[model samples]
Target: MIRDWEKILLVYEQAVEELKIKFKSIRKEYRNTDEYSPIEFVTGRVKKISSIIEKAKKRNISIDSIEDGIEDIAGIRIMCQLVDDIHRVVSLIRDRDGKDLKIVEERDYINNMKESGYRSYHIIIKYPVHTAFGAKEILAEIQIRTLAMNFWATIEHSLNYKFKHNIPKDIKERLKTAADAAFLLDMEMSAIRDEIMDAQQIFQAKSTIVAKILRNIQYLYFSGKIEEIEDIRDRFFDLNEEGDINRLKEFNNYLEKLMDKYNIRKLI
Candidate 1:
């Protein structure tokens, strides 16, 4: 049993690394550019391995022969940016593995979730794992979520752990409220992303100009132009105080009005 556990762990770790690389490549290739890294998603699976063993032992189940019956995180979740992206990612995963990969089970939690619950996608995949000792076939669970959905799920998970589902009424209500907020935030974020990207481009451009000025000033100071640097330093401080990023959005609104009046390109 100990050897089996060790073997399982070894195989599982390698599977996880392989999955991580695959996920990263998929994210990059498809430009799903949200911050959901494979490591972030796979930690739950690693933790569930021990639990799966324990549960199997209780049921007098053969660990080697177990399917979804004794598996916990043999399941995977893939959080996507959009509903369509979820399906695309799933299809990609199915097609990418050249080995003996089998799609054993699937659950579309997004369409199937109960009301007041969050959304996600789940898949069970059976894949061959090769080790120095031998080759073993195992099942893996894949879960996918949108960025906002992932955030809500992660926070809800922590809350469940902290409260153990015996949460007070008020806290439970607050969680529901927060879930609603997360949903709204997701929509708002998606809507404003293009504008944010545009602003980032402007910021990057202005920042380049600022960098050049600072470098020139530094050069002057290094060449013993202390008094001239002091003057530039004062101007630098003034600019810094004026260009505070917290105030930029307000300035952007003003720029919008000015751009409207002048019919020039808007500033961020």
Candidate 2:
């Protein structure tokens, strides 16, 4: 009979390798550009594999057959950056094509929560994993979450694990309140991200103009003496700070009038 620890270690290693292969295959099939967290999947599988091995030890079950009925962590949680992204990734996961890929169950905790719970997606998949000894079908769990949602869940999970699901009432209440706060935090961050991206685009547009003006001035400086190049430089600084396209166009028109009156193109 294999020792309990040996069985657990062997299964854990096998599961980890199989999960890596499975993730790679899915990623290629979906053409996913984002990075995935394999550590979360491995950690969860280890816990489940250990539990199953412990039970097998207790039952005096000597499994000569590789097909032992074990269903613990056949679920995977996939965390995404946004609610929309979560849905997109879920669609990809659902459409994965492989002989071993089978979706046994699915849960969208983000939408199905009783309270203001944060968002995450989960899938329970049964994939046939071949071990060193023989071919065995094992269930795997996948979970997906946004970064903020993941942070909250990790803390909550630690609390539950520490207390063995018998946490104090006050702590439990505080945890729920914290979960609510995390939900609000995600929404606030999403809004802030959109605002910042919009602002960045505006900055990029203005900076492009400023760069072109500066380069032109630099090029003209080497050729000949222009009295108003200093004025052009000053205008560049002004437009940079204003970041207004209309104001920049007006300034450009003024510079053009000055250049025409002075016949500055002949100098260039």
Residue-wise lDDT of candidate 2 within 209-263, one digit each (tens)?
5565665666555545566677778877877687787687666666566556657
- The digit string of per-residue lDDT tens for model 1 on 1-268 reads 3445554566776776677666666555432332322222333355456666666787888865555465444444556554445666777767855554777777786777534466677777777778888887777777876777788788877887688757678877787787777767756766875665456545654565556555555555555524555765776667667876434434334434534554443222
For residue 267, give model 2's deviation from the true position in Å. 47
TM-score of each: 0.58, 0.54
The runs of at least 3 residues in candidate 1 whose Cα sits more than 4 Å from the true structure, single-residue gaps closed, are 1-4, 30-45, 48-50, 53-68, 74-79, 97-100, 188-268
Per-residue error (Å), model 1, residue 258: 42
Q: In model 2, how many backbone clashes occur?
A: 18
Q: What lDDT is obtained when candidate 1 is compared to the true structure?
A: 0.61
Model 1 error, position 207 (Å) = 15
